[model samples]
Target chain A: MTDMSTRWKRTLCVALTGISIVTVAAASASAGEISVWVWDKAFNGDTMREAGEIYTKAHPETTFNVDDTASQDDIRAKLQTQLLAGSTEGLPDIVLIQDDIAQKYLQSFPGAFEPLSDSIDMSVFAPYKVAAATLDGKSYSVPFDSGVTGLFYRSDYLEEAGFTAADLENITWDRLVEIGQAVKEKTGKQLLDLDMNDTGVIRMMMQSAGEWYFNEDGSLHITDNAALKKALETYAKFYQADLVKPVSGWAEYTGAFTNGEVAVVPVGVWITATIKANADQSGKWAVAPIPRLDMEGSVNASNQGGSSWFLLSSSDNKEEAIDFFKTVWAGDQDFYQDILIKRGAVGSLLSAREGEAYKASDEFFGGAPVWQNFSTWLGQIPSVDYGTFTAEVDAAVAAQLPTIIQGGDIDAALQAINDQAQQQMQ
Target chain B: MNPALLRRGLVYALLSLAAFISVFPFYWMIIGATNASADIIRGKTTPGGALFANAATFFATVDAPRIFMNSAIIAVVGTALTLVVSSLAGYGFEMFRSRIREKLFALLLLLLSIPFAAMMVPLFVMFSQAKLVNTFVAAILPTVASIFIIFYFRQATKAFPSELRDAAKIDGLNEWQIFLYVYMPVMRSTYAAATIIVFMANWNNYLWPLIVLQTADNKTITLILSALTSAYTPDYGMLLFGTVLATLPTLVIFFLLQRRFVEGMLGAVK
Candidate 1:
């Protein structure tokens, strides 16, 4: 028994040492590889890979290594921890950041990201896209997808309610409520699905009027903002009229619309892929300009969610990375058309709108030039300064959504939001 | 019905409900792997015929062999190192006489109250200074000296017989020989229980490996599966298939040591 136990210990030690040596050997990254970190495998990952392949075709020495093995939340946590530690060893060459939270990182870790406007032409992309990443005089990111808002509705349901595509164009939120009632009365489908935890619809309404949760100097603007008040009132009207199918999470939210339990989905262009995934619903769907707030300055166009790529200052292959960005991301119009057709990615490049793919009609959306319409709204989206505290203010807003939808006073809720946001911002 | 019989039936019904609640997710996951993504989202509970198609998509998308190898290496090595170091500390604390023994052990337990989130940045800095970032060494090192595992072993060590140590000493065996030959064989059940616990924790570790491992090829199956679920249009069938594959190693480990695990949990010397 004693000899057997001693031999077992010896085997364990040998196995451990052998395994460690093999793993360490397998981990050595090659030189000239521009490693990128992205979240989505099908959307941003494949897009970046295709761009890298194009760049590598022209320049043989440089290659790309894109890792899409972390979720967006996981990537943020990893990036934030590494940056906080001031450790540049494991940091990627480039990372994808959402437009709303770009300012948070830029302010917290100055000089951590390379300012790209100095090298890449900022004028070539949409103004709002460039403006989101610009601080002081330099823009820090090359914009990828546009989250320009659209009113994706079931055409069969709307037609059954005696409505047309022209009826949805250039309407306000109140008019939408009326149209929703008619549709629900005739077709028996709910107007839309609303998740109380998400402040997306409210924010989209505010953005259409060129207002946000913050002032120009990054002060709380929740109270005394007419756009916000109107947006809240309109939000309450949906629940008051029983026109909403209450959902909770991302899966339920998307599932409600995809399963045809809801008639309309007011969201960003990024949802095009999710909607198009239900291929059997082709020609049953149609896209229109998202409805605006019934305020003086509001327009039919707004944005909900979008993300961009930021090059890190710790990159060893800076020249190769910038050139790759310029050649594929900024200058390749045909590349934009390819991503648009294949992945339903609506690129922020203004010139890409003139591509053949943008001109071609999609049969999935009733043969309406959906891509062209999205690009038009993409250019018209009013740019807002998403301050470093947008996430905090967003939480404050989400907290009051339940009350706001329950016929609570809009002004009282605004005051509550302002107080909560003011406390958090400090 | 008689009151005693009714009470027994009520207890069995409650146990059945608890069992169903615990077992339903695994059932749903298995059934989900056999259905299409759309059908899964539509809440289809019954099994379908999409298992082969889902497996094909999963295989095509993920480099399963490479990632599973990465996960296996980290989990196996980390578990071994933890058991060796922690069990030795457990034995020494219980066996040897020292002035600061209990004091030092208490201080180590106190460190457990400090959450991993608070120490993560500093830990990352230390690993980066050692130039081990992005390597499996960085992923496995911080987890090896788990304080909770040490505490567990010390409790289990309380049941170890002191007579064996005295007998080995009279026979002229050294301390190392006693620990290896007598103590180890007697405490085999304790080690089995620790193996299952440490293996599961290391296998499911996410945030640390996510922060340390940079490249795609160096990532683990847990990280890869998480990324797959966050896609705009996640294919539930393929994802469930990947999860079933990811869950197999842990299930196998538990089954192999199951009887010993139950005994070890009751008491090491029993």
Candidate 2:
């Protein structure tokens, strides 16, 4: 009995081992496809798949597997884990990382992304977009979307409140606050919906003047930075004067104005598709230049959120990935035109603005040249060095937001932010 | 006697209330699936006209059957293998309590406390070396030797009747025979509980599968739901619908196992 039982155990162990070897062999025979990782199936993933189709039509041998199955947060966690593990085996050939987290990866892992400046003409892309990806002057990333802010308002609502679109064009934050209050009183609709947790609006206001949470020397630039102070003070003014309808998240923020509870959505020009989604509100909508800060150097145009594509240095197929991006993303102007019409994506390729799509006017905006205006504003968005610690600093600022709204001392809050952000950055 | 009855009543009440509290999030999730994105965000409690609309959008956009198949294969294969391996180790640790193996088990317990983030990279590097990356086998292998399950089996095996094993040994039955026949049949409840726990964990597993599973055709439902939420302007109605579907497997397993697990746990305690 003992001898038979021992033989049975040995056979069971050997069988399991044999099965594993068989599974591994099956997985290795199929390996021609290049995998891609990116967030946003509707936005970036669909865009990449379209670009991939363009590539495969010419080169039938090449194929792409774009994994739009992970969220932005999930991709970050997964990518960071695999890369830190020094395991490039399962990593995607090309991954879409947000511009803010680009430096974090580049600096942490020195050999993670290939310098695409060698393969593609980095100059054809926006300078600020290039700046986000450049470390020690070797640029990475084929720049994707631009988050050029615009003041999209209901023209009908503004007219009812006895104001004009021209009144919003090139106005300062202080003047807009007064206008917002007056418009609210007249129209019984808030001027804008403000998400309590987000600091995007304030960051946009600060960056319009070409300042961030850091100095030109890359030191903390809060506390006494005039632009920062003005941005916060102006932000408080929106809430205190009841010029804003309070919101909690993206759904609520988009809901307020889309449902006509508010008059304006001063967000990135990327939101145009969403605004125009209500075809019933088409001619009623018009965009003004984004409001400027009440301080010097603040422009009517500032960026909010944007992302760029980076090629992995560890990829076996680097040349193909770079060539793929350059062909469709960097070179194809018609492709840009199509994406703009289809997805409301504004490409960072400066030459793309000169495409036929840019010249077209929409009946949706009452025959206004909305795309032309966006292209003009895209040029004026003040360039800022979104430093490596933007994520850490942003989290710190978000933590103190309730205090900032309650008229807390800007200096004290800045000091608190600097302390917490410094701790987190380390 | 009256005071004792009151204490027992209080205990049952408290346990029932705890179960209710644990279950409310799932109820809220179900309710959210029935409402529009607008109403869901407003914290609406009631169902709305949008369940069919939300469901239709989900079925249209997602390859649900393929995703479900991927999830099912991983969970079932993973749980079966985990049970076989972990139960052996558990039985081995209890029946053969020697100094060297006990010390090794202690070390494994310490290893369990180390966060997954720290070990993830090293494991990935090993998998990459073997060229096992992006395979379901890669996803299933590392978790099969779960220390938590090993610990669980060892504890439960303490209650295992040694007298039965002694009687079998006297009847000339070997260790392997005793384990397969006597131990396996006796520990049916333990196997059932472990199967549910391990199956649920593998089904809801996100980060590892997200990293290792490279292709959309190879993706699981959790990954799909997560991706749906990350869009520039995600359709929340569709996203919620996906989450409700993603959360169902774990909920189903929990409900099915709860009655038996409760009875089994009570019997073991008594």
Candidate 3:
């Protein structure tokens, strides 16, 4: 009995001590380390690390600790939970936030993020990037990457269809469908791959016309939104023409283009790395400006998935973080060139377009200055205010996708989307 | 062919189909671990020559030793604590005679109906207030008192022979001694079953650990693997390799306790 009780006591003692040791070890992050939370190691994580290294070299007192051990959704859940719990202890000094969902955080948790506009020059970034994190005339983020939309197509496939790169330039969605049909007939390959669960194509189409699911006042704008109606119609046109190879997830979607099963990929600049990953596909892939909607205000350029870095209001090393941001992120032009070349990261700094890396032609894309073309389009991407309920509206939009592609009434679909979005917003 | 023989053949075919359905994903994962990311994305089901390269990438990208150690510590410690706490409650609820015992057990079961999502914020607030955020303790603590495990143990305890407790008592054993010496030894199979269940749960736990364990060094393999999958260009081969490694511990535990686990499920005393 004594032996058993002694063993139990010893075990309890060891466990309690072990827990305390862990608690102590975990609680002690050094004073000058500016911890950052980023999702992708190759893209944002390494880019931020490079910036941090530069800042550390100059300053010497401050160092960075970038944690990319959580997915974007996981990070969002953690940040949202901590913010709602009103606990700032677990949050990092800086966080990478996607542009579309930036409003949800800023509005939901006011005073949670430190406004960067006062210290950093918001004008140097693309207007659309700055506008994403701006609330009440103060921008909260340092724009990192530009998700500027481009039409990356297989040049060989296009040529086989008796079409040149010039034929794709400045085309409308309707014209693209005709081109797609011609390409399909000639090459026997689908024009593009699409996932119905993703509203990316539709969202990009609407954003090209400088519109979103919400009006200026942030109310649900669906039924009468001309841009949305046209976008949905264009989406259906691809399915109707059988130009789309129906894919389910990210792997299949990327696989379709990377494996040469599809001819074109119209997506953000961030997909450059993914497309470029297949080394053998080099010289075959060429990028052109995205096809515009056939509307009065619609442009050829649009935005997709981009993110910006926000300083936490609870940061202990605020001045150092702000200085690091200003010195490396906002001021460094050559740094942008390095990340672009190494990681294929497209920065939102407008000045980076003038850098030598941007002007250098790539043999990969048949010696075309694809980066230059992307930069040119980057300037023209129509900015839209992705309201707080974009995610909710996006879900509503995605739910109606199956019916919409089957020649369902666009007006009726729009009404359903609107009703669903309205209910979700509440 | 004879109808009986034909039916037997059909059953064999169906059983084989069922077994393949159950095992194909594991086979695919192992095959994927040996292939390149591009090959996997291309939907290649056959093996390739990228196993070493994939493993090298995974090791270079992740601190595999530290990560697995963290996972092991959480899983082992959590399993130990959950078995002890929940089994004790199970034993007490079954062995002791209290007027409100059934009502209290019912209340605990009722608490199980409340989703973890609803309680997460409050739990976070509590841990943050305790200055326990980012600690393994925080990750392990919340899961140790799992209501489902307690309920599972209580049901298993009903099958526990109470006459042994009476025997131990008559042999001059106190309540604590009876629980420690007689009850625990007799319920070894139950403990074995709960060990696998709790260990697997602790090992594969995602959301709570993701929220609590903020540092990269402190993160578990499950959290890391999930993050790796969401990378801009995920190396599927390397990810599958990591997954295979993460799965091994649970697999070993399940296999080691296989007989007892089955017996325990049947009935603890039996």
Q: What is the lDDT of every predicted structure here? A: 0.91, 0.82, 0.91
Q: Candidate 2 regions off by >4 Å? A: A1-21, A24-35, A58-63, B1-24, B34-53, B100-106, B267-270
Ranking by TM-score: 3, 1, 2
The digit string of per-residue lDDT tens for model 2 on B1-270 reads 699999999999999999999988777778878888767766688878789999998998899999899989899999999999999999999999676987898999999988877777777766665556677887888899999999998988999888999999999999999999899888877887888889988998887887777667777888888788777777777777888888788778878888667655543522
Q: Candidate 3: where is the Cα deviation over 4 Å?
A: A1-24, B1-3, B268-270
**Better structure of 2 and 3 per DockQ:** 3
Q: Write the per-residue lDDT of candidate 3 for residues A1-426, one digit (tens) a residue.
A: 969756765665565665666463663347999999999998899999999999999888899999888899999999999999988986899999999999999999999999989888899989999998999999999999999999999999999999998999999999999999999999999999999999999999999999898888999889989999999999999999999999999999998889899999999999988887778878998988999999999999999999999999999999999999898899899999999999999899999989999999988888899899888888898778888999999999999999999999999999999999899888
lDDT of 2 by residue, A3-93 (tens): 9756664665465565456653422212445678888877888888888888888877778887777789988887887778776656778
TM-score against native, each model: 0.95, 0.89, 0.96
lDDT of 1 by residue, A175-219 (tens): 999999999999899999999989999999999999988888888
- Give lDDT tens digits, candidate 1, residues B1-270: 699999999999999999999999999999999999988888899999999999999999999999999999999999999999999998888899899999999999999999998989998876665556788888999999999888988998899988889999999999999999998899999999999999999999988998888778888999999999998889999999999999999999999999899889998585
On TM-score, the leading prediction is 3
Comparing 2 and 3 on TM-score, the stronger one: 3
- Misplaced by over 4 Å in model 1 are A1-31
- How well does candidate 3 reproduce the true complex, by DockQ? 0.49
Who is ahead in lDDT, 1 or 2?
A: 1
Worst 10 residues of 2 chain B by lDDT: B261-270
lDDT of 2: 0.82
